[model samples]
Target: MKKDITIPVITDVYVAVVNEYNDIYKTQDWNAYIINDKDVDLDMVIIVTDGYSEKKMTSVFRKKLDVLPKKSYAKIELMQEDLFALNNRFKVSFFEGNTMYDKTYVFRKNTINLKALQNIPLMEAKGVLVK
Candidate 1:
């Protein structure tokens, strides 16, 4: 079988429990059967931006997750629409470095696992690159 080629980009990926509103939870209490169950369906992975400040971003990101539902899955996916929106929201000015800001891309949970979590790779090419 031929191995697929993957291009790397700038972004961080994480696995967490997601709710119907697309909220993410990293705490133990928020843990749901679907996330813990190996047989459950893998939904979408949310790719959040690094933000201007890591400390502030962490708090904001956590708050974003807190708003999500705890018992359901969010239908949010990293698609063209989301990409465009993210691109506009994350500007170069958002960061201290002189880097161009591209919307973060996240994989659907089905494509990720423990091993995958060890290293979350970013997509290099422009636009949404789904596996």
Candidate 2:
């Protein structure tokens, strides 16, 4: 099989575990974000834990993004309880221009610095894309 190329300009990826409060549900929600940059449109975006299996660490989050438009990004909330942890591997797969591309990101709990967390709302609200 041929290997797909990684396009750096296509999308800037960000992974984070956030604490969100649901007004409707009246409960605290922990979510993970798979933010993509706005430069390129991404399709079939799938985020999964590396070394995933039925027995251990089998968490997969999939989304079909027809287009992640430029100057804009997408946020995917992970359902998994434990989002921030060491040795957590996240594999992101998507399609760009008919070519399927994928990359694996390892989390070390310190993945998102304190400064980055403060900017999450700005990023989400203002379409601020960061890497």
Candidate 3:
């Protein structure tokens, strides 16, 4: 029954796009990161990334992590500047103990620019976050 179902509220988890200096290229690059700000560890983390618009679409990308420790982060992918024009989505799923949780984070079209940068919690650097 609907009344008996439990829907967990996801908090403290976030997807952020940070612009950092690339040592090999000697240039700034945009990268995606998954931040786990929760107090407990998360297990079996899976993230699916995709992007689309009316006239264009991107290939689906998947990333997996065995465990994400408390108050830590992992780099998901290197986001190209071209992706900024499309609506990007990141679907995250993971487990806390015996319970499973999932959520989707989206960065709307043209929303990943410098104008949208902010202080990303736990990551010390500034970037665009979809919480």
Candidate 4:
């Protein structure tokens, strides 16, 4: 017999990256969000850069949120450059129902290889959770 393994589905909290183009600066902007779907409120929410363990890059961005109410979201704007490069990782931590939760997400630029997005006026990547 063969054993099967399954990854747990995250149900209580979710995170997303929102990207936008700045017309005034002619640069890109990134915003992230944390949504709490459970009845409990999340507290001490923090987002930090997790440089690749074997790499020599330093995280240039950090943000903190006091609380995320149930069925609501908390938002933060990320640093504007080199977001798609390798070793750019995001880690989020929070407490829900007195339990701590933490997760990390790495940018997989190649997986989102859509050259056409470069030509579009506005590219939206909404409701995208950790992958």
Q: Which has the higher lDDT value, candidate number 1 or candidate number 3?
A: 3
Q: Which of candidates 2 and 3 is the stronger one according to TM-score?
A: 3
Q: What's the TM-score of each model vs. the native?
A: 0.21, 0.58, 0.97, 0.61
Q: How far does residue 117 in candidate 3 sit from its true spot (Å)?
A: 1.1
lDDT minimum window of 10 residues, candidate 2? 121-130
Residue 41's lDDT in candidate 1: 25
For candidate 2, write residues 1-105 as lDDT tens digits. 236745544336565555566688898665556665546666777766542323445445455566655444455653344433334566777777688777776
Q: Candidate order by TM-score, highest to lowest?
A: 3, 4, 2, 1
Clashes of 4: 0
Candidate closest to the true structure, highest TM-score: 3
Clashing pairs for predicted structure model 3, backbone only: none
lDDT of 1 by residue, 1-131 (tens): 23574433433222332221224543312111111112222222232432222223221231112222323333222322222222211111111133322333334323322232231122111121221
**Candidate 4 C-alpha error for residue 6, in Å:** 18
Q: Which ten residues in a row have the lowest lDDT in candidate 3?
A: 115-124
Model 3 per-residue lDDT at 3:
100
For residue 123, model 2's alpha carbon misses the true position, in angstroms, by 3.0
List, residue by residue over 37-77, the lDDT tens digit for candidate 3. 99999999999999999999999999999999999999999
